[model samples]
Target chain A: MKLVVVQVLLIVVVAVVAARLFRSRGARAQAIRRLGVLAFAAFAVVSIIFPDVWTRLAHVFGVGRGTDLVLYGLVVAFLSFTVTTYLRFRDLETRYTRLARRIALDEAEVRGRLEGGPEH
Target chain B: MNTSRQVDTSGVWLVIPLYNEAAVIGDVVTRARSVFPQVVVVDDGSADDGAEVAREAGAVVVRHPVNLGQGAALQTGFEYVRSRPDMEWAVTFDADGQHQTDDVLAMLEKARAEDLQVVFGSRFLDDRTTPSLAKRLVLRAAVGYTNLTTHTRLTDAHNGLRLLRRDVVERIDITQNRMAHASELVEQIGAMDVRYAESPVHILYTDYSRSKGQSLWNSVNILVELILR
Candidate 1:
């Protein structure tokens, strides 16, 4: 119980420090993301300390041991990050496509405007 | 820093792109009046009175009804030069006076004598006079990438102080606006195997230029622009 309390205190301290550093960059969105990551790290720490919780998860997942449940959690986290990264990539692609279309339209308009200008 | 001491009189065209640069437009125009004969000031849809002052200063003013990028304004100046058969070479100059006005003749002389399709007045070519450390690093990285990708040995790729041959103007068309167009120029020009050289030049890092300068973050945009292109 003492170890758990100390771990929680450490986690909160790390998270707050990490969040402060991130916030200074003027990227509120990224700072929030970093806070979320810190929270996730805290959750992992809690899962690690409480072996019984993982045992319960193992029973639910029909796994043999608590370590198996931990492995399962890791796989889930990995897949989640991968999915999120893919979604982010898709969002970036859409944004860039729209941006390219806008530039193309702008170029056509300017070229037309120039060609239509006073003749030499 | 007048060109009179260095070389004889030569027909040098100064291309100044003005977009709401009216505050300093009169002073810049007045300054250029003494030097360049064919100074074409492209008013890129200035809401202010830049065109009037430019014309008053004996500069051949070209007004774009709407705000176009510097590249477009430059193209307009090039078109003007194209029309003028007497134009031996056209100098790509910045309206902000970040570039040295007197160095124009020197740059042109080097370009003309060397028979280079394009001669870039490089600040980093000689370490004797260089811009800020941050600027130098960014410019070096950009130039290095261009050199590697385009197979060209460009020491400073981002410097706008450049002289272009009358014929090579038709070969290259700059479409990218903002600052990324500098890197793109190397790729396009290199594709055509254009003869290029670098000469030492000075940069005036003024408060005005610092304020007007692109964000260091925007250099990433420039890199991405080159990558995408």
Candidate 2:
């Protein structure tokens, strides 16, 4: 099967999204993500008001139909959403692991003291 | 078993990350405590009374309020050991009773003889430990990936039995709350310029341990976690 231009573009976009998953999180990355959401929202409103604009843009991007373009966009958006959510959960898990470890150690210390002292 | 000629392992602490292994943890702790008196079982929010069993079996039990993964439990155990000024060495032992206490003693001897900071138990260094063919292949692949990525050449990257000095334990911070923590630990250790060696260990994959062991599918999750992290 022959690969199309849209296929290459979509693959590249997906690669970029995957790469972003490993990039260090910071205010700059957060700002960029927020701007992406704002731009996506603006585009959604623009497309809803002027549906023909998607078809025109699809033609410029070498996609056959506006629906296919929207689908590809949705795929990238969903992937980024999943990546960010996963990173956020990892961050939260690290924090809680530290917290739980502190409490567990502290409690163990108190119990050890109550039992007289450490077994060593 | 002679108490007079036995090596001074009072400074050594065996850290076992306990989960829902109430059926076997007590026995494991008791047996290990016979050789290494300082045994710490980090109970990772078990529904069973494994913590009580381990405590009664003469192991100091550290209970997590919620179920964190084995990696987190291990880090907690490490932190706990680090707090004890008397503990000079820490051994990360398995909770499933697969690791042999003799192997731990041998590793400790090797560490002390060579003055090494870390002694990793390697099942593939000899033909003593026999795993299933599929498990062997998966473990080889996992170790290959680990060696390639972590800049550390190890025959067994996922082995649960490892001996670390107090300084090495203090330097380690395992954030991977799952199977990936194995590779994460190795990677962190590799980054630290410390004297390290590997000792041949026999893993007794009994019917009980085989049933409790990690599935081969976790290799994929481990790879993903390492890449993403």
Candidate 3:
């Protein structure tokens, strides 16, 4: 009972902190990533406190064991995180590539003038 | 972009397309004047201080209040030269320094010998040619597209380096206002069955040219401009 109370309090704190941060940032992408981390932290605290909750939920779903339930949840979260991260990286990479090419072209034109080859 | 100054012995006249080439406008004007003798730099609604630079370079400046395309600049130049009896050949050059003076000489030579109305300079025809592989592919594609669409049957369809006879300058109607018009020049002229020639020219591809020019996605914008405008 005591452990459950602690878990409830920690979850509430996580939720409150996450909400505050999200409100200030307006659920911006960075904030959302941070929120995911905080959410996982809150889940960890909950699992540690109410050890029976995992097994109960797992059996309700006809899973073999409580650990299996937690493991399955983690696997799903990992996949989601990987996809989002990949998309974000790809977006950033494209933008940088464009910028780099532009700068390169500018440099070449300037250098051509300096070299005095007279090729326009 | 070549900065070395020379005397304008040739009776050739110059026309430049300007959007925001304020920094280099003076250089283009001065160098063109020293080499070609007569210069016309069109200010395509340059929000910057390009007008002042053009004047300093000793060019007859034509200002467009809004940013028009390079084709408009060429039109303005041609119109100006056609009115002037002293003007013989009009050279269409890029204000961005993609064109060099040596190519201008080659264009003049071809224009005079063939008694042709217009001469185009092809970068690919040059010995060293353009440096970038990506640019080579894009330019090749653009050339092929221009040849097929314009039926000009010229080697270098879109090269800016060209010397135009006063008669050709007076007649060719270049309606497209944006960058796509550069390639479209061949098509428009070909439709009229106008005569033209092409010779090798140098292209100095710097990082700036690639960046500031038409982008991969901008082709859609150009297509829409063609269809709608």
Candidate 4:
């Protein structure tokens, strides 16, 4: 009964997440990402319902257990998420730094002019 | 003290970056102005009156609207100095009062004598310089990393004090807007094949400076920045 409840909960969560991801406005890459996520979620549901199916698939992929395969996939997915997030932050920081430098240079030029110096 | 000969400091400019250094900026600017003819302090958007204090100490002050890192501050100073037609040399000093003004003058003399484009001050070369064992190890690791990547034989990789010629300053631009710029500068110097020298200089590591300076974890972050970026 607990297993049935967990499966239902997982399906509900994945459906909501997949729907949100699909409805969100973004580039074509995002759509492809949503598809990948949905497919992975469906595979997770299948593995949870039919435990032996995972073991059989694991053997084909040369794995000893299905849990190990899922764990490895989660690790890779997490690392990719971290890298993408870092890249986004890095992009934002670059833009901010440029803005800061421009403001600084403009202020210095004005101050120099007021002090009777040549235009910088 | 050798007070016999007066060194000519006619067109040299000292650029000191201050960030919440209200306790020491005033004295540092005053002392630096005594040695260098033109002292320019870049207040990197500090919350305190570091800019006002530095200006009161007779240093030319330029304020950033927001707090950028030390690298951004130094670049601002460099940009300001580059605009002046009479400026011949640019020296980057620390606002924490760890660097000695006399050593700056000595390095200036050496750079002038050797016609060097850049002169970096290294604390490891001086026996009087004292840092904790852990700090020394971190610095040594930094040196090895810098040397390995830049292919330059530098004893200290992250020294705050440096003297650059006007032409050399015009050649390269500082892109790293933080502590990582130290390593970036070395890489640029090597890539550009600029004429550079390393001088043994004194660095007074006070409790305040050690606290304000880079921590070990930041060193790891710097390594990551170097690799990923």
Candidate 5:
């Protein structure tokens, strides 16, 4: 029963992420992501229903346990997500700093002109 | 013939970035004004009357729209200085009243006499500016980290005082908008192959600066930024 609930939750999350990826407006990229998500979701559901199948698959990869494989994949996925998000934020911050600096310099120019000379 | 007497500061521009430093900005501006004629204070969106205070203290004031960090503020000042064709040398000074006018004079004179591009202040070069054991340890660690990363043998890595040619400031861009900029500045200087020298200067530590000092968490964050960047 617990395994069934876990599989349902995993499928729901995968569906949501895959839906977002589908709407991301890239043809080849979206198709590749959709295929990847579907494959993972199918694997998760099959592993939930047939626990021995996961063990067998894990053995093919020289792993002792299926749970460990899933855990390792989750760790890699989470780290990649974090690093990509951080890079995006850093780019945004650089643009923001440039905007702030431009505004500050413009204000100084106007103020300086109003005062009848450059700002000292 | 005294080379010191011949060192010219007629084209020097002083840039001071102030953030809610109404209490000490006036005194610092006044002191800096006596040595350097062209003083520009970048007000980093302070809530108080820091802009008015600095202006009244005889320095030109540039106001930012929002609270950016010191690095942004200094960049704004650099932009302002760059716009003026009369300026040739630029100095970044702290508004916390910790730096001395004599140090600025010394660095400026050195930059002029030696025809160097950049001059950094080194407190460790002079024993007069002794800090507490904890602060010293942290600074030493900072020095080690900066030297390792930047590959420059700097005696003091995080000192806030510097004198550089206006062209040098124009060449290197400041992206780290906070405390991390100090490390970034050293790294850029090394990368640009800019001729740089370190001068022995004294850093006065007061209760106010100690109270407003960076926390250990912020230091860790700075290290992460440096490493990641």
Candidate 6:
């Protein structure tokens, strides 16, 4: 198979996105994510206004068609979205676990006091 | 019951993570309370009256408002045990009555005799526990994966029966809120610099526990959780 410029670029971008899924998470990461989203939205508007722009850009990147480029972009976006959603749910679970544990312990403590304390 | 031969196990607390095991939880709690005076059953939002049964059977029941997994229930029990200054040891026992109280006493004895901080109840240490061929294969694979990932080497890593000293219990923070927590616990304990040993335990696979046992397919889920975490 002939290696195309777009293939190499897509591989690099996908690798970076995958690595970002496991990398550091903080204000900086959040800023970068927001910036990516803003850029994506702006590009979406541009593509909608000028549909031929993706074909011209695709030609520069050695891709077959604009639709192919969009497909590749969608794959990367979906992968990152899945990973981020999973991590966010995990964080939510941890927080709720701690909260539920506190309530359970506190309730048990109150019940113990009301019952004259835990029996040995 | 000879009072003179009784060992002073008042410092030991049995932490049983209870779910909807209303059929056998009462008898399990009663039997465990007879051997270990301090028993705390963490009820993980059971629809049945298992929590009430545990309470009536003389166990300190800690009820979660919603249904959390067994791992969350165990952590709740651990937190509850940490609050009590009188508890010097905490044993994580199963609520399904598969775990033997005698094995708990033996593990405690081993911990005390060797001055160990952790004593894990391993079914593969001896031939006492007989699981089916398929179940045995899954357990073997689990232990193998655990040993490969963690620094510690053990015959069984997914066993629910474990004796942990107060200090070790205080340091353990289980984040996996499901079946994956077993491997997570072993991984955390392996990372900690604590003296640990494994004792042979007989896991009785009664009809009740057999029905409640985790499906073999959960091993795949556990692996995904560990890897994704």
- Among the numbered candidates, top TM-score falls to 2
Candidate 1 CAPRI assessment class:
incorrect
What's the candidate order when arranged by decreasing TM-score? 2, 6, 5, 4, 1, 3
Residue pairs that clash (backbone atoms under 3 angstroms), model 6: none
Flag clash pairs in model 2.
none
Give per-residue CA lDDT, model 4, range A1-120, as digits (tens). Answer: 544554465457555544543344358647766777899899889878998877786566666777765765675566545655665676677778778877877886787678776522
lDDT on C-alpha atoms for all candidate structures: 0.68, 0.90, 0.66, 0.80, 0.81, 0.90
Q: Candidate 4: DockQ?
A: 0.29
Q: List, residue by residue over A14-101, the lDDT tens digit for candidate 1.
A: 5554444433334675566578689879977887788587777666556667786566556544554554454456456445433543
Q: Residue pairs in steric clash, candidate 4? A: none
Predicted candidate 4: interface RMSD? 4.9
User: What's the number of clashes in each of the models?
Assistant: 0, 0, 14, 0, 0, 0
| Candidate 1's TM-score | 0.63
Best by DockQ: 2
Query: Which of the two, 1 or 2, has more TM-score?
Result: 2
The digit string of per-residue lDDT tens for model 2 on B1-229 reads 4333367798999999999999999899988888898999999999999999999999999999999999999999999999989999999999899998889888888999999999999999999999999899999999999899886889999999999999999999998998999989999999998889899999999998888677888888888888776
Q: What is the DockQ of each candidate?
A: 0.03, 0.81, 0.01, 0.29, 0.40, 0.80
Residues A5-115 of candidate 5 have per-residue lDDT tens digits of: 555655676555544533343577557656876998998798889988866765665666877557755854565455545656777888887888888888878878888
**Rank order (by DockQ, best first):** 2, 6, 5, 4, 1, 3
lDDT of 5 by residue, B80-159 (tens): 89988988888889989899878888898788779899999999997989888877887888888888888588988888
Between candidates 3 and 4, the DockQ winner: 4
For candidate 6, state the interface root-mean-square deviation in angstroms to 1 decimal: 0.7
TM-score of chain B of each: 0.89, 0.97, 0.88, 0.96, 0.94, 0.97
lDDT of 2 by residue, A38-91 (tens): 999999999999988889988888887899889999999899888989889889
Contacts from the true interface found in each model, as a fraction, amount to 0.00, 0.72, 0.00, 0.55, 0.76, 0.76
